[model samples]
Target: MQKIIVGVLVATFSVNVLAWGQLGHRVTGAIAQQHLTAQAQAVVTALLPNEDLAEASTYPDEMRSSPEEFWQKEAGPFHYVTVPEGQTYAQVGAPEQGDGISALKMFTATMKDSKASQADKQLALRFIVHIIGDLHQPLHAGNGTDRGGNDVKVNFFWQDSNLHRVWDSELLGQRELSYTEWTARLNRKISQQDISAWSDIDPQVWVSESVKIRDEIYPQEEKISWDYLYNHLPQVQERLKMGGIRIATYLNALFK
Candidate 1:
């Protein structure tokens, strides 16, 4: 029983480390779905007949509990990349086991391969949706020092939490909005200029942007509250919007 409890805790921590929380992922997916070209939308429909991208976006993280080796081992590192301060991802490069950008490139090739099995394509599409969102979460582009801020403990609104969890969910949760509501609110703020600027699908550009934001986000105080939220929410919202646009841009290019 004690072993089982420990396993559960480990599994939970692994999941927490790998995602943008369900709401954030779903919001990005929904926004992406809206921006997808008709051809891309048709392809997505063929690949995922029953579920929307929002549902599909959470697939990788949701599978973290699986006993399979792929989920248990290989896939965890696909959610984030680490670049030490002052170094670019190009300088650090992907670890031999691979990182988010490497996994994304592999999956994208699978998605574009006409001979690939439907199961494989489905996995690729879901992962593409997810990794785009994951890369947008600034912490996912860790500084290679603090486990993406998971080690930085803080009291968030008097609740014991770490900086990673606060960024991953707590700050967004404070809005009291569902994923769709968040999507709706964010989508309105996206303009043609914003879309044009964010439409670049280069993962390196995404990582660089994230690394810059990640550096700026570390909190000074151990106690976090409205001031923190008020300061960072714009960055959070912008990242989500960019993630969504880039997902659409990528898929539209893929299926075009």
Candidate 2:
């Protein structure tokens, strides 16, 4: 089975190590940047003058290779959460290692701190931008047994890959779209009412959303192909769209 989309690829950094991969995150960033309010946009520009959300979206994932202690240790859990099959994220609660929900709250506060240095705030903003996007991919809030599907191996379009890799990049990468093209392709209609409907900055709520979709992401067969792709591609699109809208919502509220 396989899925669908439009456009050519723009090369980026390592894809296998991150949630939603590079293109997905950049698409979320591009959509979020477009929807940001004037005040929010000003704040974003102030922090990451050269890079908009599209470019800044991949910063955290890129840091996976960093020799810095913070990136090596503190940033891993911030990229995903583990909400088991039946229980809600609340019942299980985030562990002491910290999760996307808590990490996001931490980053949000850092960005909002007036006493925080420009360097610190910039770093926090990038983290927030990236993590919010990460939390939307259903596999990020994994079922706990499969290491977010990393252990669940499969052949995607005849290549060796796992469930997590399929969702992260295989699907998006197969589209052959640049981040800008992916952004434009996924940036759907966002009316004022739609914006109002999309509000709610809680990361826990975001986790719940992921859990619901996570249920639909799997197949009984390890040999998934085109049919499997067609069924779940819509979920990928929806998640990316929601990720962008919600990121913009949080930043707008934060800066407003």
Candidate 3:
């Protein structure tokens, strides 16, 4: 019975473990690229001569399928931070294996270390871009229950899904827009004031914002459809925009 129960729980929560789908991450990256300071842009161009931020934004998730030990076992926790109900991230701290907050610190140090190898800096840069996008997805800052809502089954647009997937991809996917199209539309909505307000580079602040959003987004019913989309789409857009802005702000400060 114990084995059976464990298997069932694993199956229930394993689907769609990624935070933002490919398109969403790309959208955040593109937006960030547009916002980058000239120095940051020059450094990014030197580091990623072949790929743009949009392409780099998806590298960590794309590598999740690698047979290597780092991707297979070690890198999983870097994608999210767990904050249980009524508890702050400061109160809970990172687990033994570490989490998104620790990963950000590690990679940020790598980016700044003058002696770090180019390849190592490149890897860190890729993760920084990707992880910033991940932290923006409310579900990535899990509530320490339900595997970030993966266990809460639902029907998204009449198709079987879960609360995590709904926030991770389905909400953004429903619009059928390419990442560039999404970036174009979202960029227009960002005002100077919005940029100023969302420029904070602290990962903890991002996690806190995500946890607050995560708390309010759980569905009241298992049948999620247009109403859910209509209600939460703005929040989704806001997060993506903020993610992009912060990524730029962070890199600018780092490269400065």
Best by lDDT: 1
**Better lDDT candidate (1, 2):** 1
Q: Candidates ranked by TM-score, best first?
A: 3, 1, 2
Q: How many angstroms is residue 86 displaced in model 3 relative to the true structure, after the best TM-score fit?
A: 0.6
Q: After superposition, how far is residue 37 of candidate 3 from its true place, in Å?
A: 0.7
Clashes of each: 0, 6, 0
Tens-place lDDT per residue, model 1, 19-133, is 6699999999999999999999999999899999999999998898899999987788788887889999999888766789999999999987889999999999999999999
Compared with the true structure, the alpha-carbon lDDT of candidate 2 equals 0.82
Q: After superposition, how far is residue 45 of candidate 2 from its true place, in Å?
A: 0.8
lDDT agreement with native, every candidate:
0.89, 0.82, 0.88
lDDT of 2 by residue, 1-256 (tens): 1111100000011123488888899999999999999999998998888888888889988878898988766677778877879999989877666778888889888987889999989888998988899889988887766678777889888888899999998888877889888877777565677677778888888889999988877879888778888888878888888899999999999999
In candidate 2, clashing pairs total 6
Candidate 2 local lDDT, residue 60: 89
| Candidate RMSDs in order | 4.7, 7.9, 3.1
Residue-level error in angstroms, candidate 2, position 48: 1.2
Colliding residue pairs in candidate 2: 1-225, 1-226, 1-227, 2-225, 2-226, 8-176
